[model samples]
Target: MTYKSDSHIRNPEDFGKVVVIYGGNSNEREISLESGQSVLSSLKKSGIDAFGWDPNQESIKYILNQDIDRAFIALHGANGEDGRIQGLLDFLNIPFTGSGMFSSAIAMSKVLSKKIFLEHNLPTPKFKVIRTLKDLKKATDIFGFPIVLKPNSEGSSLGMSKISKLNELEDAYKAATEFDDVLLAEEFIQGKEITVTILKNKTLPTIRVKTNRTFYDYFAKYKSNKTEYICPGTSDISEEKIYADIALEAFEALHCRGWGRVDFMCEKNSIPKILEINTVPGMTKKSLVPMSAQCKGINFETLCWTILETSF
Candidate 1:
């Protein structure tokens, strides 16, 4: 169902006690804290009896032991997004925002998700798995120079690098492996970067990301002010529809539900290549999902309310 502001529950009391999950023991803990606070504030402002829950401080058993009727997962990376917490919630029989355990695990792994993308005939960057120097050598030989190296399971552009030469491979691989055991060396698609946010099985406006950095790294995504975002990605209505359609298809391909974001790299006249899917995307002020929602006339409170409704 397409989620509009007016279609959501008007009374926040109906939501019961909600938990905004975030701040786990991950590389993205800081960001998760920010996202969780942002979501908690929005939910509270909307009158939804919501509070922040950091898994690092309190265990999942503690949370399940609470009176939480549903959860709004704002956590990113590692144990938080890797289906561990989702499984706990599933066992507790507590509804939560975003995809379930299976989909969460698949979406968190870059290697597995890319395989699904290819199997489903979805356009994604050509990629090769990297676990050793020998694998890196083979990837360099096949993909040539200017390949993107990133952890198999990471977010917020953490441990991602654009290797322009063979000498940089080892360093890039080392950085990525610090975050995940498996690394992915993908063909760098030189084009405009765009992201599409999906809510309630419907696509929101697309945002074209422009960064002065070599690529949209962790700094460019959250720290850099040089980044620019252009909404309604294309001037042509047909092109916009194409982007939205592809985004919706990609989101569904992974069985991603509730709400999520699909990132793409597109060149003129070429099909947009799916980069990855974010099941529990950020809710910070600089986040793409909230930015896209505002473009569609959905305020932060309404967006949070609509997302919480998905837990039902």
Candidate 2:
């Protein structure tokens, strides 16, 4: 049986073959809903048996409580993207899409990720994770002004602030704590903001984010209409290839599976530095992964189906 909805694609066959785990009691509920809809649409189109589940408080119980062979995770932020839910799925012996617990954990924490990147000789922005305002002055002096303060374990640019003066450090720290305790202040790199989507060790393409805003904060990332995305970034094939290779290598180093997206910052030299990795990237209409995939002839629906097929 085929059923079509507002998203795109056919309904899943072999009903109950796969279950899509989505939504949660997280603040990013709207994005999660959009992601869930996209996944549901694609899963259905692929003729697979899949259904959507919120997995709210008792997510583990929710999965085991139901008859689900496999899970396609569509949740974002905190409980969903932070590896807690992935760990639950693992314990339940349920094969789920996206990276495993360890990978998700590393990707979730910015402080830990930068440490790993440095140890692995991967180019990443120098950052300091300050636990209190006492360490703020020291960190700022080292990283210098124009620092980006964000939660160590948050995504979607939530609780992110750019401080160019010492007086703003306190406010930035306070705002960042709204998301997580250890606040990360990275040396604000003045360059192009790039996003790379990878699947099966293959980096799709380089997407350069252009926004009228100062940095690609929450507004520029999710809300602002002033931002423009160039799928391939530039006409320079050499730079694009370099970014793609670096992104693929970074993805492999992080032990990501199936599909993921990496964010990078490129300096004037065209050197792309690792910003972070998104295990369960957004699949909404304006998401970077889908946009990058579409550049290579894969629509949002097909890109999602490919991820499902590859993951399980």
Per-candidate TM vs. native? 0.96, 0.91
lDDT values for all models: 0.87, 0.79
TM value for model 2? 0.91
Per-residue lDDT of 3-112 in model 1, one digit per residue for the tens? 33224676889788899999998999999999999899999998889888898998667776689788889889987788988898888777888888999999999999
Q: What is the alpha-carbon lDDT of model 1 when measured against the actual structure?
A: 0.87
Worst 10 residues of 1 by lDDT: 1-10
TM-score computed on alpha carbons, candidate 1: 0.96
